[model samples]
Target: MTTPLKLTEEYIFAHDLREASAKIYRASTKALLKHFRTTPIEEIDHRAVLAWRKKILENGLSKRSWNTYSNHLRTVWGYAIEHGLMTHTTINPFRKTSVVPPKRASKTINGEAIQRARNWLTSLVGQERCTQERTQITPAWFWLAVFEMFYYTGIRLNALLCLRYKDIDWDNKMILVRGETEKTHREFFLPIMEGLAPHLCRILGEAEKIGFSPDDQLFNVNRFSRHYHGKEMNIDQVESIYRKLTDKIGVRMTPHRFRHTLATDLMKQPERNIHLTKSLLNHSNIATTMNYIEVDYDHMRAVLHERSLAQGALSRVRRVDSSGTPPTSAITAPSAQIRLPSRKIADPKPTTLQPPQQQAAIEEVIIDRPSRSSGPSALRKALEFASAQLHSGSMESATDSPSDQIDQNLLLTLMASGLGVGTFRKRTQSERSMGSTSFSRASP
Candidate 1:
């Protein structure tokens, strides 16, 4: 009732997953069969399996694919060993071998690239591409809408392609990607970008004229042909569409390229203090975001040094006597007109003096938050003011002391500005009047 290859095929469907994982097993099985020809299962040895793995590796299989194939082989051999089907099968060489990390596709889009792709898609919608065939896509804007969804929301290609009419909320401007309908199998709500929102409204409004149902697909492009019974687009085909779009737009790209570019752009700026690029990309790791967020360290350091020199911060401090005069050094001054500042004037108080014991005691106060700040450093001000009011006497610090001085200084400024207005002044005074410790809860 069962042959070795048939058993292997059944094993494949039972254990492996992720559309790509199964193909790796199938490829490994085919390679093994080709090598062994007529060898029985009990007679198959590690040597033959290793040769199969070697062939797969040599035949241009990616490390990830090889690693996956090796994992399957190991599983099969492990099953055989555990069940006494093959007594000599030991540890799998493939699983034991070091795995090369998979090369992840870029997942973000740059602004310029997004703009170019958007403009191109805009120009294509409703335009006839072929007079002989008497057929063209519904509208080029529809394609751009899909790309915009990915660029703004970081949805997987599969999820975007599977979007149905009901997937969107016309009233709320939210798109509901159902979990069962996603590649990661997790449903998430994506807020519509401002640019795409009206375009979507128009598309839905136009489609409504034809009496489209909520279950109807939003786009009718010939992108997904393989799994949709000739109607819907699947993940791979959706990716292919993006690829073709990028090519047409003259920008090398993939669906994921948008995600990478977006994440990088979100994080890669001198003034980018909010720096929620990872959260924007919906990444689980800071490291994964850093892959694209990597900065030119050499260039940055060089710029920093140049600025330090301009500010006189890079100059070595001259050793001097208590009277505040620089001692002569073997190194001569440069020919530039730059002159060193006066020698350091020591603080009136001794540097070594410690704060009084009473000053170190914990104090806490509570204050009501007014309008929360939305600047790059907004969180700092909101949290710092909240904490300072709780600790009127300066008890404990924030859980994450994010630039404490800046936060405290900003809070002071906000408090002063609030005092300038009569209505706000009462609210601020009442909030500050609450007993200390309102913000700082007792430590466990």
Candidate 2:
């Protein structure tokens, strides 16, 4: 017995969509009622829908608009069929249309713009203190609270305006967004963040001054007004207030921009926890959260700078002592100017002959030797020195020396030059067996 108009009312009520969403559905359905005012449910056909759609297209409506309006009608029709208000025998004419919505461009807010907005807010607070109407601090406190809450919570503007004093659990330190007010129509709670807590308290104190009940709206629009001061505010009025606030700072921004900026900042943390950012933004799909993160040049530059510094320090060749002993720390200083070992010198052989210059160089090398704790720096230097020796085609000195007296860097250098330790040992042993005089002689 229910008509299409009555069925539309029932469907909207059952869904419990937010006021803004309900308004859109109603507007879309209003177009349908105007076109088929007297048509019976069973008599409405595909031809009638096509004529209505053609008129909408001729009126210069966008594909997104066509899709939205068509979707609204289709949902209502489906609801009617499910409840037996209309027969399912007839095909849905709206679905047969070929309209497609265009892809939306990703939007992001500038960090510098946010900072400028904050500065403007701070200056406004200072100006309020200097005013003669210091007794009425509620208005100033209310706007401050609104501005901070929007920046910190990332909640939708309408959801925030709909918040009541009861929604805040001061004891538990959380704000609950009721399912009725939420865009998703699902209830969720946000933790009271550190920066946002003080502003909440300020507004709470202001509300208490008027004996605010649990059901009273958190933000009083009348208090915020400079001219048309009143008890309540509509969506248009709330947006107007926000526009004026941002205009003062000369930055064009909206409540949703704060959400994007916060999401991007959270994703840029050291951990880069995108899952945590998704939960914070209350996004049902992770892809939606990913869309909010824009490229940050500042963080990228820091990483590249650190990489360059590492390469510069690790790519240098370590210096060798002129006297053929371990190099003095003064001659082969670490690239970072840090007093860490830059190369591994061989264990010295027992003293035999001591030329004055060689003996002085050896003494200085021993006195300036780095501690065992400098292993990492020593390893880096060894790699660098070994690489240099490979390119220069250098060989280990064949002068008087024990097996253990060979430098680790020299061993690595020999290996890089295609001579393993085993091969070098075999060659040395063969020379000894043949009584070769070259075994103890210095290289020419």
Candidate 3:
């Protein structure tokens, strides 16, 4: 029977993973080896796995870290089963383990903070150029270029570090991200954006001055660092630079934050093409890219304000004052018409108190014509027509025919009622003062 340690070793050797991946695998199983030691691979059960998980968590490892460890062990067990090192009946201890929810939320760096950092970096580089020998490029300049590249490209740090002069396609203006340097282990190309072009050119010139061939790393540690001379720049060294900068500037700066910031800024654009953003980020799945974006509440609020229904209604009301008629397509007949109930008008009493010669007239006004529809366009046309007739002095003309007067009254009534009861009352008073007849309320 093979021990868990021996099994992990065999698994790592069989997979032939890249150096970064192999390192991660080894680190993932460190706790597992400390607990299980020489125990038989088949003997570890779910209960034991649970106890180990508790121990790992107690040791201050996060749930996310525990999950990663569980996944690697599960993979190693599957590999053992596949290779006949474990019996077919053996179950994966981590198969039923529930993944712990991540504790920290994804975040993007503030643009203001980034701007401050950039200003500081620019000042630092300018000072370095003044103090340093003119023949050699300063480390400050290299870091500034790295910072700009992060801001513009959103490329992963490892992939950016792995880049070589040969990877740049000047003709196509693209950067080739090698598969070995990527987390997904799949190669893809990223466009060299306009903002990043000059920085790239400057860095390339510096690399050439330092005798770096096309095949050599684009950013070399040896060129600028005395301690790291003759050695390659690794992730830790890059992180140390950011750490020092963060201390000086009083902002938490990280390479991954640049990736997050780029995704969010692209998403906040008016176009907001998520697919295009995903392509730029080189994510195999759009869901992964989604995790990087921070919601822009201000942008969302602006969109909502622009497309609100209330604003649309107010705009339609304003259009009613315009001279242009509403489109004919919007003219639909309403199911109801305006009918004025019969009302008795009192005659003026004689000074002598004699009986009035004529009986009081009981007049009824009925507009049997189809009323305009409730739609905004139809209502707008009715109001526009009424307005034109009122402003053209047709209603005020004494020579106006009764039929024309009745038609104008009908339109006025429609407009008033469609607007509101208050408007209806105001219109009635205004029309009466203009010597125009008032519409009576219809009996139910």
Candidate 4:
């Protein structure tokens, strides 16, 4: 005869959750209580739970919100079954009822907007207070410290609010995060960075002057608010301050956006250590940290630009001709030729040959080279030089060394296909003689 409301109250009491977690749990169960008030836990079946889910969507609640509420209820039901509040045969209707929410890209705050807000806060920090103020320190200085801590450390709003004076270790330069304040309920430590140390020290000095004990909240609300003077500042009051600043800066500002911005900026660094960023942000899983980062297209473009082919080592094009002289009538000058270091090759033995046979052999070698469909203009010029050499009858008078002739053919192949010549094996004497005979018969 136990009801969901009674079970939820018992579950909350048994678990001893933190204030924030307990508040969320109460709110989640409140939604269920609206639909199933006074209904027995054994009588509420899957159909009733489905009807409640439909009503939530009808009320304009998002799938993400529906999932969150269902998760809390499901956990409560599981706890009831474990504690013998519910029958072992009874089914948990809330289990496996969540739908995957559609993913939306998270927009990061613009760097210029953040800079403007920081500048505004800095100006406020420097201003002198009027005589009417009760405290010597202005509220702006306290808010400035909070703003810098959010920017530099990227701590969550809840954890930041829960921070105490004793958590800071000045000698170790670290701040201990309590498990109760963390979303994952795990204790961890964060380093006090160089840029953030000064602001923290200033705030600590002010807190000491006010005689705050080690267990008291680090950020004193008393400096600014008369109502919350002795009490710790809550989320709504902090959000109200950000909303006012958003209006002044013409850009929306929130505590979570600071976490997103810091995560993205760290990812854009040259090292781009994602694991390090996860550790800094105190994320339970690396995947959760990944969702916080936004792609920096400009930085990606700069990296890709540096790898372009036009600016690479192979950009300079050279033409190789066996005649060792530039063609005058048939071939035009190349656009440019950059001198590159050449490797030495052993000279080959001289081979005697008839003039006609030599001319036909050179022609066959030129025609046998692979065709390039997308060859550069330099490759076209090389083919033109070969035609000029054949028509000008310069092959008979050529006395180039065998190594020079082989290098000429290798270079022509390289220019045509943009491939390295190392893989192209040299033709043997028998292969050259065969090519000469084949070209001699085919000549018109």
Task: Score candidate 1 by lDDT.
Answer: 0.54
On TM-score, the candidate that comes out on top is 3
- Candidate 1 per-residue lDDT over residues 1-444, each given as its tens digit: 333566566666565355555676677677667767787765555566666667767888788766765677767656655655544446543456536767665444446776786766665653534332222233355556666776777666666666787888877878887766643445567778896787678667766776678888776444321223555545665666667766766677776676666656555566664337654554456776678653546658888989888976634443334554564222222211112223222333312212232222223222433334334355455445654553442334434332232224433554454321111111222123332111111111
Question: Using Cα atoms with residue i matched to residue i, what is each candidate's TM-score against the true structure?
Answer: 0.54, 0.59, 0.68, 0.66
Model 2: lDDT equals 0.63
Which of 1 and 2 is ahead in TM-score? Answer: 2
Q: After TM-score superposition, what is the CA distance of residue 86 in candidate 4 from its true location, in Å?
A: 1.2
TM-score, predicted candidate 3 vs. hidden true structure: 0.68
User: Which portions of model 4 miss their true places by more than 4 Å?
Assistant: 88-90, 105-107, 129-138, 224-230, 297-444
Q: Which prediction has more favorable lDDT, 2 or 3?
A: 3
* Candidate 4 residue-wise lDDT, 253-320, digit = tens: 99999999999999988899999899889899999999999888999887787776446533433344
- The full ranking of all candidates by lDDT, starting with the best, is 4, 3, 2, 1
Number of the candidate with higher TM-score, 2 or 4: 4
How high is the CA lDDT of each candidate model?
A: 0.54, 0.63, 0.68, 0.71
lDDT of 4 at 259: 94
State residue 74's C-alpha deviation in candidate 4, in Å.
1.2
Order the candidate numbers by TM-score, best to worst: 3, 4, 2, 1
